[model samples]
Target: MKGPCTPCTTPAALTRIGCLCAMSCALACVCAPLRAQTSTFNGAVALSSQLVDRGLAITPATPILQAAASWTSASGWSAGVSGALQTRDPGHLSEGLAQVSRAWSLSSAWQMQADLLYYDYPGNERARLFDRTEAGIDWIYRDVLTVGLSATSMTHGADHQPRGAADVDFHWPLAGHFSLALGAGVAQYLVSPYDSYGYVHRPPPGVYGYGHAGLFWSHGAWRIELDRIATDPAVTRHGGNLVAQPWVGTVSWSF
Candidate 1:
């Protein structure tokens, strides 16, 4: 079983651990009061038809079980953790995350959020190489539309460079409890010569785009969604077909 580096003996690892601890303590101090009062806690469990991330498929067509829990304070401070495990190999985690975020209302109709995230992949070597800290900012409009940007400095990969992504999404309400969801995004990376995605360009040439269109239905705490997911031909050719299914479906219940 793969696990996080322990003992913090190395200088680099120790620095990373120190930074993480400092951030955690800071956020805890800020949110402690609000958490004692008007904070809300939410959780969800879902079954997904496949696992996908940033235009790349992380799993074949095999289904995965996912769970997430979050706490949001009335003052817009939030923290969350989420994880998924592929049913085909349920003994190990496929993906995991810990995140902290702050949101502000830009106006009556616009809101912005800034967040820090950590990603972990336990069993897949290629995926694990990209595991790192990510920072993101997002602008949301009227709970229906959002534009988001994120970047990461990937020290675990051979490149040890930064990568970024931008995405836009729209959720349009229909007559009843159903909605239309559409989104698209692109990722840019400085491809290492030894990168698993297989590009060996000197100027760092790895760019891919992805998009999804789907319908969502919600009633009470239960939600059902089906999306037709697609990636650019380049992603399919390089990222491997095993992680590139055409359609993904999910059913989730939240509380």
Candidate 2:
């Protein structure tokens, strides 16, 4: 498959199962701090039926277990770290992330956030295993809707060209302790010059989309979510495309 993207570093093909799983949540965790009024820290745990990103499962069929911690300042800045482990027997570290972000109020109802994140793998050291760096920006509305765009380039790896992505999301309170959430996103893939384990059939420069709907519940410090997820073209690898519908259950607490 493909290698990672790091400038001046050798780039690989398009095998993202590992890199995407390890870094996406790690980087995304930094955004949690934007809501804190003063210095605050919190942690949570989660389980997912599949490790999904850009419309594909990075994991082989096993569930993914996740944990994260974040700290935020009243002054529009935050940082966080997270880790995920795939719970198959002899389970190994899936991914770890470290990220930081800052936000600026763009009026009483809109805000802009910028982020930088790094993806790390503990012991995997292939010439193609260079770590990844990601940067993104988000436009948030009334703290319930978000529009985001991002670009990432390999920091030290091979020749993976820069990638672009965008997404939109909305969450609304439906009743006491209940809420609804919807999201849609897409990613653009660069044409790979190297062989892609037979996945190169999608012409060159491919794009993928994903969508999801979820029900959320909050009681005391516990937060939970159940989501129905779908993707287009699914994937050609693994069990050959995805299931008709997949859902994930997650529970977390903030202390």
Candidate 3:
């Protein structure tokens, strides 16, 4: 599930220095697993040149700083938080997210996951309610194919309708440590007004599809990916089926 929102800024700031400190802590946790059937923690930093969510371009086609930390239990329960900041002044938007998920192994090669995601924006909100909350599920087959469906609703002084989407993703291993990933999903607006939905500059009661293709490489705890992504019934202001950014690339480490 995907939705968008923005909120007022915090009195203090979390600069790059702060994020680095958090990442260091996360790495330490990764080495010292916790109890509860086995627990793991990991962190990563990413420089994303384009930020797109559910087919909407929340930021310009410039690099953005992102960081994340997550811990998972061997019993399939997990919790994590992540944050993103703009690279320059007048950035206007910054966000943090908290997530909780529980997964189950159905068989030797099948798994199911349920997730709840909350998004909070910090900075000037212009007195608009844009916070969003999403709950979704995913099914994975043989660790290579996945189907996901989810519903997203608003919170934190935002609209109270739900939007939903269903997506399937395929991952195929290539030579060496590289792999290919392809996916597409269609979304429906369950209950929303006709004009202007949170971050979706499009009319409500709309149904549209989104797609992505990417190449991935993995070595140890490090991963790198380059992708091209697009969505249909794109916001008219963007002038096409794709947002201002059609390309995105990322490099991250688990620890």
Candidate 4:
């Protein structure tokens, strides 16, 4: 038998770590605002499907429900909580996640945010329970461009993995009533002692990256996005390949 696969320690991992460090320094240089001002409650439903590997596929034809509420004080400080229930196929796999976030305006053009996410995956051999924490800062320039850097660390039972990401987004107004947002990002996952897929067999540490660009059209209370996303080979081996295509559609409604 071939020697157990070695864990990944790729150049991409180093680059991601460097980006996270840079974001931290940038966030520290600005003074955070002291108050919050606005709040909102929102809900949405969506359906998704994807093909995994060459032979496995899942069609989440049923709708998934999600809801969230947020409050921002007068000083630009904010806090929010959200939850979702998603099901793809009966007797196969289902997941639910709850998350909370806090954000502060560091300046007129810079903001910092932190979040904790708890996820439950039921009836899946890959993962049953997971929890993660993420922190990041966003820089908004010219009222149209936003750049962000975030770091995420997840724990499943005793396994631990950390990931880092950098993203840039641009917003464009359409017809004065609609808006479009386009962005792309890259993510790198740090290897750990645990197997890549929950099995005892060790798998090589892989670099996973993705790019996304989307268009959102808003009309009254309804919003729709035509999105395209693509992931690297590392993610393909990590069970996210089912919907790995570069295209997907998402819709939302507000009341």
lDDT of 4 by residue, 1-255 (tens): 000000111111112110111111112112222331234333333333321111111223343333333333444444434333344435443443343445555666655544444444454433333334555555555335666666666655454556677766665778856666565556554332143334224453544455545565666645555555555554455444133455545454433
Off by over 4 Å in 4: 1-63, 87-95, 122-130, 190-205, 233-243
lDDT of 4 at 37: 29
Candidate 2 accuracy as lDDT? 0.52
On lDDT, the leading prediction is 1
lDDT of 1 by residue, 1-255 (tens): 001111101111101111111111222222332335678666667777776665465556677777766677778777777777778888988777777777777787776777777778887554666577777777767656767777777756356566887777766889789977677777774233235545423323467677777787777767777777767775544444324577777777665
Q: After superposition, how far is residue 28 of candidate 3 from its true place, in Å?
A: 17
Off by over 4 Å in 3: 1-37, 90-93, 124-130, 156-158, 189-205, 233-244
| Candidate 1 pairs with clashing backbones | none
The alpha-carbon lDDT assigned to residue 123 of candidate 2 equals 33
Residue pairs of candidate 3 with colliding backbone atoms:
5-130, 9-123
Q: Residue 224: error of model 2 in Å?
A: 1.8
lDDT of 4 at 147: 66
Candidate 3 lDDT (Cα, whole model)?
0.54
As for lDDT, the candidate ahead, 3 or 4, is 3
lDDT of 2 by residue, 1-255 (tens): 111111110001101222222222222233344455568765656655554444444445566676666666777777767666667732566666676777777887877777676766453221124346677777777756777777767655466677877777666778889977677777764323123233344443356666667787777656666767666553333223232236655555544
RMSD of 2: 7.2
Clashes of 3: 2
